[model samples]
Target: MAARIDEEITFRKLEILLAFLEAGSLARAADALGVSAVSVHRALHSLETGTRCSLFRLEGRNLQPNDAAHALADVAREVLQTMAQGIRSTREIAGYAADRIRIGSLYSLTSGTVPALIMALRLRKPDIQTELVLGSNSELLRKLRDGELDATIMGQPEGTPDIESQLLFEDEIFFAAPAGSPYAAQSAIDLAQCSDERFVSLNEGYVTHDRFRDAFRVAGFEPNVVMTTNDIFSLMNLVGGSIGCTLLPGRIRSVLPRSVCLVPLLPAFQMRQKISVSFLRTRERDPNLLSLLAACRSHAAERPLASG
Candidate 1:
């Protein structure tokens, strides 16, 4: 018997007990708790230890709560209600309960796609609050996996089995050159021709840099990467000042200055990177997750492609 019932009374364990009581079956209770049946069963044992009483009895096919459980139902309800209030109060204190939505995104997509989606989500749920966390693709994916994000907009789906991803749009990579530069007037340039030109690349950890390296391998040549920057904006500025040529999305043409020309790939080594929203597959049935997914899909359908 566990004597530290109060000490062991976690919100999750309490919720599990209450869910089992209300649902009358472990399967239904697990569904309500957003966990597997095994987890729910484990929680029941923990709950029993906390309460120091046999909560369930073995039946022919189904497990049924005993008298001790029925007696403890009132206490369980109070615990659950208190837990619910705590969540509500926390949300109120954060000011997020007032109709706000939080999102995450990769730095590359945050500039254009996120803003458009925020505005669009607002149209559907007016007065909705919005928060966007921007980071590298790996960082954003990590946050999404840890339950720290509602969903994330990033390039390429991660390899995590617990995550779910849906492609929203496609973007093509292109060559970026300063305006009025000799290369600006060209329709395209062969990778071999670019061998002698100084290149500005993303930092080694960046997915963009990895993609560029893969393309180089395909082109059968290594680039003269004289400069490296972590942010695309910095790389763009360097390219604008004629520091060096860099690879950029052709979609950026609308936002960039007319002086900078987006040259097509000569052999057209355009890589179609998928912009997607990722979330945990375990949370797929959650009401909040469902609402956010529908909102994201609806928003994606209404917004234009990353072109500009």
Candidate 2:
């Protein structure tokens, strides 16, 4: 037979035991835990009974803590502290709101949108700690679905009906090129005219990369991408160095290098990216998610999605 687990020993009793030992009297112990003296007395009595060992001695009219009681009190403090740490660790792993709130975002938003929203979140939840995970739209959506993230701010993903999202803004994709490129002088450039242009693009999962493919497909030809990178920043740097042309979101305009120019795509090739804060539909009522939604709504109010 399996050994019987001790059910009598519990956190409440241990807490009372610690208080009773340190406070020197039942009344003081009760006051420490905001309970009545009788409750403290009963809890200590139960704890001693549960230990199955002599932890107190009857001295005339009062019970005095024995050496064992003192030692057990130390253990009790350690147990409480260790349990507290364990709880925090579990919550962090689950990305639940305990000590930290984990947020996911697309690399494109890092320049401005993500930063502004984080500041807004801090104002509403000053005590809550934040952890940010940046990745592509596909990657962030996967993480959010898998419970690894508390919320995500990105170009709203497609076909993910399970996610609850708050629309923050909409952004248009722009054709990017070297600042000195002749395309900079045009009011709009047809992708067909740049069919021979060498391009540097972000990897497959990025919203920008996916949108690039869609836009090129609409233009009725495949882009001659000379290079592909996992990040948007490097792709932009390549554009700045004239390595090749690329596509970028309008939101990225604030951080684009002076050596690069973002030009409008002709009507046929234009794709609007709807940026949003997404979380599990079930987690809509979570305090952290609610705060995040409020922050996004506030951001949307101050900076509406650009009109094409």
- The C-alpha RMSD in Å for every predicted model, in order, reads 8.9, 5.0
What does candidate 1's lDDT look like per residue over 1-308, in tens digits? 85444555577777788889899899999998889999988888877887777889989878798888777777878878888888887765443343555577766766567777776666666766777887777777777767577677777665678888866777778888898788877887676667888889888655677778877777778888889987887888888888888888755555676657777777646555667777778757644445566766886677555542
Model 1 ranges with Cα > 4 A deviation? 1-77, 86-101, 124-128, 303-308
lDDT of 1 at 213: 84
Provide the lDDT at 290 for model 1. 59
Per-model TM-score on C-alpha atoms: 0.68, 0.72
lDDT of 1 at 294: 73
lDDT of each: 0.74, 0.87
Global Cα lDDT for candidate 1: 0.74
TM-score of model 2 (CA atoms): 0.72
Give one digit per residue, the lDDT tens place, for model 2 in 23-114.
Answer: 88888888889999989878877877788888888888666899999998999999999998998788667665665689999887887888
Q: State residue 198's C-alpha deviation in candidate 2, in Å.
A: 0.9
Error of 1 at 239 (Å): 0.4
